[model samples]
Structures are given as C-alpha cells and as structure tokens.
Target: MGNTVIEKIIQAHTADEVAPGRIVWMDLDIRSARDFGGPNVVKNYEREYAGLPLADKSKTYFTFDLCAPACTLKYADNQQACRDFARRNGVEVYDVDSGVGTHVLMEGGLARANGTVVGTDSHMNILGAIGAFGQGMGDVDVTFAFRTGRTWFEVPESVRVVLKGTFKKPTSAKDLTLYLLKVLGTKKIALRSAEFTGPAVAGLSLAGRLTLCSMVTEMAGIIGFIPECGAEARKEIESYTKTPYSPFSPDGDAGYAETIEVDVQGLSPQVAAPPSPTNVKPAVELRGTKIDSGFIGSCTNGRFEDFAEAARLLIGRKVKKGIMLKIVPATRRVYKELLARGILQDLFEAGAIVVNPGCGGCAEGHVGLTGKGEVQISTGNRNFAGKQGKGQTYLASPAVVAASCILGHIAGPEDL
Candidate 1:
C-alpha cells in the first residue's frame, strides 16, 4: 500500500472507492466544530437527524474561538450553543476562550494519530499541512459527521502545483497562493486538491506552507497538500505530530488531473481586488489609489512574522490622515507576544488601532469597518461581497498593507 498521507488515511478506513460527490460510509478520525460551524451542526443534529447518535463523541472536537471578539450576537449564541452541545454530548472542546483559530488549534494540539478532520469552515483543509486529509463541509455534512462518526466524499482529482523557483522577498507563501489563485481562477480548481511539490515548496517554513494550504478553499479547492515530514515540517511535528510520522508524496506514476508550474522568483507583493480572491493585480498597479482603511490581521496573515514585518515598516511612521487601520492578531498568544515585544505600542504610535485578538474587522462585522464608498487595503484572505463592510477592499500582502496604511493609498514597501 502507498504511504502517502491521504492514501494511508483512506486505506485505514478501507471504505469503498467512489467518484467525487458520491456518499460512502467511512470512518472519520476527527471532526471539528467552531462558533461559525458548530451551531448549525448542533441544530441539524437536534432537528434534522434527531438522535442518530454519534459513533464516538470523544472523536468530535470543538473550538470556541472562531473569529472571536469581533463576532456578532448570532455568532456569540452559536458559540454558547457549541459549548453547551459539547458538554451535553461528551465531546471535547479545545481552547475554550483562548481565541486560537480552529485550524491552528487542531494542528497545535487537537488532532491525533493518522486522523481525518472535517470542519464547517473551508480552511480546515489546513490540517493537511500536518499529513492529515482534512476537508471543509457545510452544516449538512457536519450533521452527518455527528450522526455517523464518518461521512461520504467523492475522491477529488488533484492539481499539482510544482514550484520551480525560489520565492523572492516580500513574496511569502500567502503571496504565492494568491498569485496561484489568480492563475487558476477562483472556481477553476473547485472541488479538487492542489498537491504542492518541488524543491521550492520544500524550502518554505511550515507556518508559511500552512497559510498556503489553508486558503485553498477560497479558490474552491476541496483541500490542499504538501509532502509531509521534511526538515521544514519538523518544527510543526515537534509541536503537533509525534509518533514517528513518515511523510507522503505522490509516486512518479501517480495520477494527477492537472499540473500548473509557477516561477516565483522576483514575485513582488500581489493584491486581490474586491469581490474575489482571483481578481488579482500587482501591488505596484495600485499605487496612488487612496485608501480609507488598512488592516493587518486574519487567519491567513496574522502570524508573528506578519506583525514583525508590519512593525518594521510602521515603526516610526503614522497612518495617513483619514485612514483607520486596525490589527487583530489571530490569537491571544500572538496578542501577548506583540504586547511583550512592545510592537503593539509601535502600531498604536503609528496611528493604527490594535483591536482585540479575533476575527473582527477582517470579516466586516466588528470594531473597524469601512463606511459607505470607503476604500481599504488589507492583509486578509478574502474580499468577498460585504466583507469588511459596504466598501471597496483590496487584499494585499502584509508589506503592502503596512506601506499602504502609512501612505494612505495602495503603495509598495519601498514607496512607504
């Protein structure tokens, strides 16, 4: 049998092979619920399929910090329901109020040996970063997970994203993925996996790679994967995957539905315009387009590296007049780290508002939102309609976000 992560998991369950979109009963190793996805799962379990009974309640996991402090009342109620549901059903709830993003919590401390995780959020695909075949589902599928401990799935075709060149500075994994999304089109890779490979991909940090894999859903991917257990992956493995995990890669003869090659050398900061992640253009193309807001936080780019880069650029500079920029670190730990390092003060001194650590302003339902007709540039993952409010949103790299916040317009790091 092949030792690839996906293959291993599939074979472990030994379910019938079926085409994509077909339902088959297979064991699901892990199932995740969060503020956004949990309520629906609970409601569906309580209403639609009343008393179907889960295979193993302990196998189900819940995280309360899905887009925290900035959440709406509906989300708040959903979170409470999730907690109540977990307690009532004997499922373990990880990080009750710690504010860790769902995927981060899973990779950091929730998912266990040779597991499969399904969550309501699309980015749950990020678990694949650690050699798991994670998938995102809607409330309906989640209800199924709660009922049977497993659900059905169509085997998705794979798209090989072979990186051939070293990524240039300011071209982090987030940028590379956005660049790929532009190349692939938003719906082009719908219901498929982008199996990342090549020397270039192997060289990136695990955190960087995770960010790339997490956003696959924005392009409508079923999931994303990179060969696991490299020196680069050791950092994550040390903290998450124990038990001598052997990484997996596709065989030379492995079948793939498509292959897309990209040369990332000299790839500068890129941006995704309003309404779609695939609507991309270079940051340089955005020069002089005035912005009313600049934000630097989200599951996609709210890491320590991202904040450090933003601080480096905004250390002594003040945000441009009429601009309201905010930083919402993805988790409480990141918030404390920045506070301890005094980066939070620097950001405040630079005229940026540092909101509570959560999914707030990034999703348009929180402390900072662009007013009507306002224009904002952000380091968030998506810019779908109504995201960040009824305004124009441009999704850019952290460097671009910092620089644009400083200049009050779309500008590159050098331009700042």
Candidate 2:
C-alpha cells in the first residue's frame, strides 16, 4: 500500500517501514515548551539529569506565550524561571512580546517541513500545515525529549479530507474548520491524522492553512495534515515567514481509514455556540444574538491577514456601544506589520483595543476576559464553559467576529 503523507514522514524519520497502529521511536527535529508547562519541564529535566547538559540545546525552544506580559505575580515568576533556565542551559527562548511559541518556532525557521516536532502545547500540530509531523505531548514527554532527543508515537490511522471549489467570500479557513467539526464531529476524528487535499486546499495561503490546521486539536486530532503544493505555495514569507520547507504529498492510492469531501462553494460562515466546538450552526442562524465582547486573535486565527480583514471591516465603522472589541496579533512581527499598515491605528480609532501579541484572552486569565451572564463572539478555537471567563463564547471566523463587533451581536461579514 502507498504511504500517506504522515506515513511517509514517519518512515523517513525512522528509515524503516512503518504502519498505522505500530509504535515507533523517532528523532525529533525540534522540541518546544511554553510558559504554562515550561517551568515544570525544567524541574523535571533538572531532577532527571541534575547538572548534565541538555541533549541538544540548540534544537529546543522555550517561550513565554501563555498569559504573556504576566497577568499576575505567579505568572511572572513562572516566566522568570523559564528565562533563567534557558539562559543557564543556553537554549533559545522567545520572551514575552515575542509571540505564540508555535508561531515563533515556525517564523524562526526551527520547524522544518517534513521534520518531526514535539511540543508541550497540543496545538503545536499547527505545524503540520507545512507538512511537518507535529505532535503535542505533556510536559513530562517534552522533558524526556530534552534529555534523549527522541520520542515515540503510535502511528495514527489516516483520514483523507478533500476540499473542492472555493470558499465563498466572507467565509475563510475558520469557517472551513468549523464546518468540518460540524460534519465529522469531534469524537470521530479523535486520535486520527487528517490529511487535507483537493483543489480548495491548494488555493489556501500558508496563513490560511495555519488557521485551518491550528484547530485540529479541538477535534482531538493528532495532526491536521496539508500536503505540500509546490514552489509557489512553498515560498518563504518575509518577516512573518522565515522557514524554507520542502513539500511532501501522499502517494497515489495511499491507505485511508475514511475519506470525506467538502465543497466550499456551498459552505457558509459557521459558529460554534457556547460549551462545545461541535455545536456548530450557520452564522446566519445566530444573527441578532447579542454579545458584550468580540475578540479576533489566537494561534488559530491571529495572522496578519486576519487582522487586515478585520481592520477593513472596522475602519469606517465603530464598535457598537457597550461592546468591547479586542484585536491581538499572533506575533510581534505581525503586530509591527499591522502598525506599519495603519491597521492598528484604524482599529483603535474604531473603538477596538489592539492588545499585545500572544495568546491574549483566548485561553482566559488574561486580557479581554468576560463576566458572568455576558455573551461573547470570538475567533478563538474553543468556546468551552469558563474558557474565557464565566460568560458564554461563540466561536466564528475573524470576519464574523469583526462584523459582530459593529452590530453588537453575532453576525457574519455579509451582514455588514
């Protein structure tokens, strides 16, 4: 049987024939940890190795991404511990104000396409958009990798997802992901690798692919795979994109446990209501639903395109009375680009507050937290109860979130 893209990657790393359901140990091209669990990883490493040096300090990265800028004293201390550890060990660290850890690694050229990356953040699978076999593990797993430079995985079965046609305007990768979650159901994708193919996926920009793949964790997927298209799609983006990654595709007649196809021409903007990402419906269905806050940022949808699209919608309009709109770029580079383009200025003038880059307010306990009994619309990946404070969160595309800010209700860009 022909190997799937993921299978090909694993085989190359191991230099041995491997198949689904088999356990294999492979060398990691990159290993990373973030602020939330990084301190614990450091402690574990110290406990295991004492004064010994890390297996490969240059290959490891630690970033202060979660609760960046230190929401409180405890968070600040945690970040400080990571910083001190990186300094002493000579490992690379992306400090607060740098950006999300995954974005930092990709932008810094550490996450190579067709390479194996293991990270402490589940959403690290977003790297698969570049054809890397990115997997998330626990802090202990990362610590083990730091010590040994190797990790194990049970090769997951593959799910072939073919996207055809074009995404209707105002609908984007976020909508595509939501529509997939709605049809596939989160439970069905658990522990499986999703390989995106067909013409629609080919048309997605690298940033859009990042947005689509970033949310695979929400569906419990091991990774969301997008086969490399070609040189044009593989060109390195300046400042925002730094990595030059080789592309790979599944062999014809590759084995897949299931195949699903989505035609974007008929797809509409979608929203996942409070308490579950799987509770999805057309964005039009949720129109007129009042919201107290709207957010446009996260690893999933915080790219430059997201901010520019949102700024376009909000420039001539003001955030509705009594509603707070928060815009956060995913990285310092993106933030700077937004400022250079006057997108940040336009957002501020429209009554939207542009916060520092990083996972702001998406995971809560940071800026833009909502209060009890309030309603919110966001471009974040999840809307689980209390995920962003005690209020309810409705997940939508960045365009939807931006339009909602203007209407003070859940809405799509078409509503504008």
lDDT: worst 10-residue window of model 1: 1-10
lDDT tens digits by residue: candidate 2, 181-288: 887787777899999887667767777889889988888888988784544457743333454455577889899999888776768899999899989999999899
lDDT of 1 by residue, 275-393 (tens): 88889888778688988888887767776678888888999788888888888777777788899999999888988888776655654444547778988888777788786679888
lDDT of 1 at 144: 83
Collision pairs in model 1? 20-154, 21-154
Which residue pairs in candidate 2 have backbone atoms (N, alpha carbon, C) closer than 3 angstroms, thus clashing? none
Model 2 stretches with alpha carbons more than 4 Å out: 228-233, 237-244
lDDT for each candidate structure: 0.73, 0.85
The TM-score between candidate 2 and the true structure equals: 0.96
